[model samples]
Target chain A: MTKVTMTVNGKSVSAEVEGRTLLSAFLREGLALTGTHIGCDTTQCGACTVHVDGKAVKSCAVFALDVEGADVRTIEGMANADGSLSVIQQSFQDHHGLQCGFCTPGMVMASAALLADNPKPTEAEVRHHLEGNICRCTGYHNIVKAVLAASGQDVPAVAAE
Target chain B: MFNFDFVKPSSIADAVAAMAQTGAQALSGGQTLTPTMKQRLASPSVLVSLTGIAEMKGVCLGADGLSIGGATTHATVAAEAGAYYPALADLAANIGDPMVRNRGTIGGSVANNDPAACYPSAVLASGATVVTNKRKIAADDYFVGMFSTALDEGEFITGVTFPVPEKAAYVKFNQPASRFALTGVFVAKYASGVRVAVTGASNNGVFRWAEAEAALSANFSASAVEGLTVSAADLITDLHGTAAYRANLVKVLTKRAVAGAK
Candidate 1:
């Protein structure tokens, strides 16, 4: 077993886990931060996306031990200090960005990272940034809308092609 | 994934020493290695994490060329290398998604040499040097075959140095599901000559397209290779595309790349 220590969602936490334990497993099973869903065990789906050291990554594709001493942020920490939805989260709700909502957490995390990096991304850029996150409900139309709206861009009533 | 011992080495010397142990492997970004381990395809007894080594993690442009640390993530390269080499930066920006790019490393991508990876094309066309803890290998001599390299056991890459090209561009047709290249072409025009490397479409992995290279070297235009055709025998044929189809894509992407090169 390996002893891993890191800050998750603004809290300092440490755990003894197997060397092969994935960051997703550490966050979901060990820390009980189930907000970071694991839709696809493979890296193909970004359902387990989280921020490590301020950059978003697929939690399933990273080992917990490899993240020692790093700061990790998950979907659970995206709320305001008053415990209300953050801008991105509120945008998703207002835009009806999700249906089944299985992939919403990952989608929200990935969108937050994109806007942090590119504050004003184009429609094509927003669509491209979501390539890793798979939404089986085919609700990408509104997901894109929410991401764009969160970035303070005007969302067209009719989704642009 | 199976249980194993994990060791984070803070220096290149220590990393090399750790990897020298039996059943040990160097872990950079863990983008490919982690997924492979989860699938039980790889089960090394020891994982020597290289990210802790601060020396192996930056982008520096010098008289030699653009030197990028082996452990530097693709996102870092995309952001920092843009000022010097836009082609390399653009290719890095499109490697995976925002999440994958955040974790995937250039060294990991080149070392894995996935047929569909984007870095191999950039490394090959730019004629970069793979600098390992032991020695430097030219790009032409570094790539052996698909998912294989000239890197010796216990040896780990420290960084890769790319020479500035007179003009270059990378164009890829991504396979929708994985976002890996169905057919990608990188064209680099230098003062000495021209180089055209194709990835994802080759059975032998990333390789220089000599016919296209010669034509582009002579004319440096899309129309120069308009009549050229690549043999389908050595191209990859799978669910994504037939060998003949890939051969056609090679020609088309090369034309587009040349037309788009600065």
Candidate 2:
């Protein structure tokens, strides 16, 4: 086993996970941040999307040991301190972006990630950015709309180094 | 997932030492490995992570050519190295979404050598040299078969030196699920000769279409491949496509790739 120390959801958490323990596993099991989901194991279906060192990645495809000293944020940590949804999260609700809610949290996180990078993405750019995160429901029309709505408003930028 | 011991070595020596153990797997970007673990396809006894060992991380343009460190992620490859190897940069840039590209390492893709993998075609056609712990492998001899390489039991590629071709291009038909190439062609013209390599089409893994290459060698034009016929027996038949279809695509994509070569 390897011991990894990382900041997740702004909390420093450490775990002695096995070689096979994925970051998704670490978040769900070690830190109890279960917002990250695992839809597919082959890096398909970005249900396990999360932010590592402020860059979005599929947590399932990332080994926890790889991020030993990095910072990670899951869908659970996307809200403000007062428990209100982040701007992107609110936009998803307002635009009816999700259905069945299975892919919502990851979608929200990915949207937040995209809007953070390209605050004004063309429709094609938004489609390309969300390619990793698969939404079986709504055919992604509303999800694209939600992201466009969020992109109109300034989403919080990751802490600039 | 089945449990396995994990070790992060600080030095390249230790990293190589860790590979000496039995059933030990070297982890690069985890773009491929972790998923294999989750699917129970692989359960190595030990995973020697190459991330912390800073020695294997950098992109440098040297006298030899463009060399990308094994642990360099695809995003950086897309952003940084793409300027030098524009065609390769295009391949890296279009790999998956930004997240996969952020973590997916070129070495991981090259080492894994998935049949339809994009980098291998570029690496092969560019006449890249795969530097491993044991010895250097020419791209031609490196990829043996599907998901196979010339690496020995404990051998792993440390880096790759892709000779900047005069012109090169990678054109891929995506499987869409994992975004791997269903049929991809990487065509490159080097100082010696124009090399044509195809991935995701052959049954015995990546192979050079000697007929198309011979035709293109004579005349590097779209019309050159229009007259030739690729043998279907050389290609793979699967859910995505048939041997005949893949054979046909190899020609179509090759012409497109050669035209797109820059």
The TM-score of the first chain in every model comes to 0.97, 0.91
Candidate closest to the true structure, highest DockQ: 1
Which residue window of length 10 is worst by lDDT in model 2 chain B?
A: B50-59
Q: DockQ numbers for every candidate? A: 0.86, 0.65
DockQ class, candidate 1: high
**Per-prediction interface RMSD?**
0.9, 1.6
Top of the candidates by TM-score: 1
Task: Return the lDDT, model 2, position A140.
Answer: 85
| lDDT per model vs. reference | 0.92, 0.84
Candidate 2 regions exceeding 4 Å error are: A153-161
What 10-residue stretch in candidate 1 chain B is worst by lDDT? B30-39
- lDDT by residue (B142-205, candidate 2, tens digit) is 9899898888887777789989988888999988887888999999877677889999998677
**On a 0 to 100 scale, what is the lDDT of residue B169 in model 1?**
96
lDDT of 1 by residue, B52-152 (tens): 89999999998879999999999999999999998999999998888888888988899899988999999999899999999999999999999999999
